[model samples]
Target: MGTCKCHLKLRKPEDAAAACSKVLELDGENMEALKNRAEAHILAERFEQAKQDAHKAHEKDQNDRSVMEMLQRIDRLIKMASRKDYYKVLGVDKLTATARDIKKAYKKLAVQWHPDKNQDNLEEADKMFKEIAEAHDVLGDEEKRGKYDRGEDLNEQPQGHPDPHTMFFQNGGFPGGGGQRFFFRQG
Candidate 1:
């Protein structure tokens, strides 16, 4: 459809997908529509839909070079999705998240999963706490976040992080770490 192609050219991938879907509904076997929709889905990071469309396109024409390339790219993205995603660790959607959001999420999750609070599940808590810290460290910094956004942060840990215990004491035992609670508590 001209609308679909026009939207794609304008870099409005979500619009392109919608337009292409309208054409596909009328003609399921339209190779151009299928291919364009698949591309739009890829740009939107909707891998499952993109995969489906790519497969359909491939079935329609196994010899299509562009479809084959799309299939390969999808496979690669799927694999990358399996990695430990810092955005996911921080419980934020990367597309709409800002630095403040990432920081807020990290603070919340870190406290919830702090090792002292999860003595019965220390191992899991420690792992989760570390993950949250790492997410904040990477995504909270412009340079690291940029590298991470570009997929260069492979298995990277939070840099120069103090041990959990040290961080806790240094911060005064909580986010504000004022140490007032300890003075008033019996435990």
Candidate 2:
């Protein structure tokens, strides 16, 4: 006899793998055991092995929804792992992030994206810099800054910043007339 799937659900990957192996020994074609083990591997982020196990489960039961779901999940995880976050790129955390820290992170990131430093790549650096700038801007404002620290939604537009098109227009730009005026041409 081997452990049921539920018994191994919350266990560590290694433990789940052991239980799954036992289940497989009892019945080599146990799709449930294979799927559970694949899930465990996903939690552990052993993606390649997880992909293999998920593929095997799909093979065993071609029409199984669980297998298809697991494969889609694995694809998403693999993609997420490939794209790094700005915090990781800067090597800092929100708790300790001061203006100085922001400057330092920017400098380091600039170096990484610098045309001289990365002769073969340029676009990635710009995208990284934009993210860094946005993070700094939100964290720097006092009300927005405090909200961010409290894990509130800082992305919400600030209260006083007027809608540009509705409130003001000058030379088709903004903030000044700049020798041009904008008004509805009403007859």
Supply candidate 1's per-residue lDDT for 179.
52
Q: Check candidate 2 and list the clashing pairs.
A: none
Query: Each candidate's lDDT (Cα)?
Result: 0.88, 0.71
| Model 1 misplaced regions, further than 4 Å | 25-27, 87-125, 132-187
Global local distance difference test of model 1: 0.88
Give the CA lDDT, 0 to 100, for residue 13 in model 1: 91
TM-score of each candidate structure, all chains considered together: 0.50, 0.50
For residues 58-123, what per-residue lDDT tens digits would candidate 1 score against the true structure?
999999999999998887787667777888888899899998898899889988999999999999
Give the distance in Å from residue 82's predicted Cα in candidate 2 to where it truly belongs: 1.6
Error of 2 at 73 (Å): 0.5
lDDT of 2 at 175: 54
Scored by lDDT, the top model is 1
